[model samples]
Target: MKKTSIETYYELFYRWQRSGLSKAAFADREGISKVSFYAWCKKFETKPDSQDASTGFTRIELAESASQSAVAKISYPSGISVEL
Candidate 1:
C-alpha cells in the first residue's frame, strides 16, 4: 500500500464519518487494516495545535462581583470569554 498523507487521512476519516459505517466495515471496504485506519484517525484528528487551543490551560483572572464574591474569568483565543 502507498503511504498516505495527513490530508488524505483526514479526508478518509471524514468520509468514514459521513458514510455512517462502522470503523471495521469502513476499513475493510477501504482495503486498509483496522489498526492503520485507527492510527490515522488518532493522528490526523484535531491536530496538536488545534487540540491545544481547545484543551490547554490558560491564565485566569479574578474579579470582584457585585455581591463582593470573586469571579474567575477565562478567555479563549477565539475571542470568547467565560466567567465563573
Candidate 2:
C-alpha cells in the first residue's frame, strides 16, 4: 500500500465529519480500504483540532467582527469561497 500523507487524512477526516455519510460509505467513495480508514480515524480521534506544530495543522478561533453588517465568509484552500 502506498503511504498517504497525514495532511490528506486530516482533510478527509474534516470532510467526512461534515459529509453525514457512514464511515463505510465514505471509505468506499474515497476508494480507501475501510479497515485503514477506521484505523486512522481511531488513531487520530483523540487529537485536538489545534495540533502540535509537527502535524502542520492548527485550528484558529477568530472573534466575530464588531460590525454587524459584515458578511461572514469561509474560504477553502482549494479556492472555493462561501459568503454568509
Candidate 3:
C-alpha cells in the first residue's frame, strides 16, 4: 500500500468524526480498509493540547482604527473567524 501523509489522515479523521457515519460505513465510503481506518483513528485520537501554539491564541496586530474599537477578533486554525 502507498504511504499517505499524516495530514491526509488527519483530514480523513476529521471528516469521519463530523460525518456521523458508522466506522464500517465511513471506511467503505472513503475507499479505505476498515483496519487501516481504525488504525489511523487510534493513532490520531489524541486529546487536544490547550497549550499547543498551533491551536492556541496569539497576539493580533490590529489597525489603528480597529484597535480603538471594543470588539476583539479571534481566528481559528480551521479558518473560522469570530468577533467579540
RMSD of each: 9.2, 11.3, 8.9
List the candidates' TM-scores in order.
Answer: 0.50, 0.59, 0.54
State model 3's lDDT: 0.75
Q: lDDT by residue for model 2 over 1-84, one digit each (tens)? A: 798877677777778899999999999999988898897788678877677424556665657787877675788989999987
Worst 10 residues of 2 by lDDT: 52-61
Candidate 3 residue-wise lDDT, 7-83, digit = tens? 67778888999999987899999898899888878866663523322344445565556455677688788999999
Q: Rank the candidates by TM-score, best first.
A: 2, 3, 1
RMSD of 1: 9.2
- Cα error of candidate 3 at position 73, Å: 24
Better of 1 and 3 by TM-score: 3
The digit string of per-residue lDDT tens for model 1 on 1-84 reads 688766676778879989999889999999877998998777656465333332354444455557866677677889999886
Ranking by lDDT: 2, 3, 1
Cα miss at 5, model 3 (Å)? 1.3
Q: What's each prediction's clash count?
A: 0, 0, 0
